[model samples]
Target: MTQLHYDVVIIGAGAAGMVCAIQAGYRGLNVLLLDHAPKPGAKIRISGGGKCNFTNRRVEPKHFICANPHFVKSALARYQPEAFIEWVERHNIAYEERDNGQLFTLEGAGQIVAMLRTELDWAGVELQLNCDVVAVIKQHETWSISTSQGQLTSAKLVVATGGLSYPKLRASDFGMKLAKQYGLEVIPSRPGLVPLQMPARQRAWWSDLSGLSLEVAVTAQRGPRFEGAMLITHQGLSGPCILQVSNYWQPGEPISLNLLPDVKNVAEWLLDLKQNAQSLSGALKQHWPKRLVQAWQTKFEFDDHLANYTQLRLDQLGTSLTAWSIYPDDTAGYAKAEVSLGGVSTDEVSSKTFETHKVSGLYFIGEVLDVTGHLGGFNFQWAWASAHACAQDL
Candidate 1:
């Protein structure tokens, strides 16, 4: 087998690994970045429907979920979103801002990948694709990596393999497995920013309303809440609102949805409509699609006219409309998740450098860590920030 040596070897040629390789190379270190995939940035290519939500305009430590909440502050503080925005501007990548400060490429996600590749070229970093790592072992001062290509050694090894989310993109448990091999702790991981599935009975009803979407306020029993557009999928529910709340949701937990978010004083409004003998469907039609209103009324078996309900019944109806409780059967799983919720425990990694506390010259960054960001461009921002931190140390 051919053997090679480098100052740094980064696994995974995704967002984090590429950035780290560029930075280390710029620092005059011989850096080699490897990936099992045929091409770089497969996930980036599909993000934001091919536009790629690269970063958010507003970012804070609070936007992330980690076992050690403070673990991300140092890296995030060192590399703000503005710095990334400046990089994008310097590359002349056209971008636009969407709701909630999300910044996306105006042309395509390919531009971002091309920009990173250009940087890597400028830094003289070596990239090896379709290289699968077979084993990783460390001696006193050097790390040995066994790959399909050959055997290699490096003074430093950075795992930016990310987490198991998009299996089609060649996502794997390699990073977490490597961490365990090194005697480091890994937090249990799960799917995040994924769609929720409904029970069979509920699924039957919701499936009928598939493709119908509306803005809603969703609250989980565990205390997390978000207001955004919710989509009725054939399987259950999705869209921004459901995806955001799913981050805090657990099995058997009840989620409440406000079908009438725009309506204040629903009880009084219903009472007046009841007194005037107005049709309930007509009132709901103002906020919901005609098909959705029809399907909801049929599933709930609600009467058409408010005259059919008494004052007490009207109050009950108002409460039901304002707080429709639902228990999800499960999430759509990692196959449909946009990001993984947890990975290498943050407690074992340095917040300032992303170096593993238990191992010298070994670092973890990006989605492979226990840091997960809220929906939108926050996850990508975390990737950039964490990579910058680890690269600076390298």
Candidate 2:
């Protein structure tokens, strides 16, 4: 078996691992980057519908949702969006900012992986993919990692394997597991940035409304508001707004919607159209889809015509139309999630260097950490920022 030795062993080849390797290499540390994936950064390639929205142009700590909200501040501030943008410019990667300050590469997401690969080359970081780590042992001043490739010894070990999001991408909770092995605390992990699964009874309705997308404000009970496009799916809801609010969603919670977001008075809108001799369904159809209007008509058939409906009834109908309530069957889970919400607890790791508070040279970063964000490229920023922080210290 081939034997390798390095000053630092980073157990991931994704965004965080690659960034850490570059940082450590430039600091004169022999860094080894390893992962089970063949190509590495598989998730990055498919992110942002292949364009790879790498970072939110406007990022703050609150953009992230964590058990402890303040933990992500230091790293985020240290490695700001401008710094990452400068790096992108230096690499000549063509990128543009989309709605809500989301930045994506025009040349496809592969450019990001390629750029990182190029940086790793310049930094002299050794990347070994298709290598599954079997075990790790803290051997006095250095750590020994047993892997499919071989045994490598290093003084510092950074776990950047990320969280379980897409199993197809080989995303795992190995980082959190590793942290636990070293006696570090870990927060419970959950699927985030995923679509909600509808009740079994609503399957027909979901299919009927499939491909129907509307710009609206979606909110979960006691959660944040997300205003964007929402799409009905076979499962339930999926789209920018649904995916955003899903990050803050909890099990058994009710989700609310502002269906007519731009229209202030739904009652007036309907009443004005009703006065034009339009049928109840036709009047609603003017503002919404014919199918949706039909569904609502079926729901309120008892009070058929607008003239027969009382003012209280009209107000109630408007309320129901404008503020729809929905309770999901469940989430689509990690397989469809953009990111995992919880992982290794931030309390166990340093907010600055991302190293474990109890362990001297061990660090955890990226999705492996408890820090998770909404669906607008915030996770990628955390990956870069946390990796940069650890690199600076190690």
CA shift at 240, candidate 2, in angstroms? 1.0
Supply the global lDDT for candidate 1.
Answer: 0.90
lDDT of 2 by residue, 1-394 (tens): 2336788889989988998899889888888898999997899999999999999889988789888889989999999888888989999999998999999999999999998999998998888889999999887888988998877798889999998889888888788778888788888888898998899997887778888887888888766788889888888899989998998777888788887787887778777755765567665555577777676577656344677667787788777777778889788998898888878888888898887889888989888888888777898999999999999998
Model 1 error, position 312 (Å): 2.8
Best by lDDT: 1
Model 1: how far residue 256 lies from native, Å: 1.0
- lDDT by residue for model 1 over 1-394, one digit each (tens)? 2238999999999988888899899999999999999998888899988999999988988788888888889998899999989999999999999998999999999999999999999998999999999999998899999999999999999999998999999999999998998899999999999999999877888898899999899998864678889999999999999989888888999899998888878888888888888899998999999999888888777888888787777777876798888999899999999999889998888889989888999999999999999888999899999999899998
lDDT of each: 0.90, 0.85
Which is the leading candidate under TM-score? 1
Error of 1 at 386 (Å): 0.3
Clashing pairs in 1: none
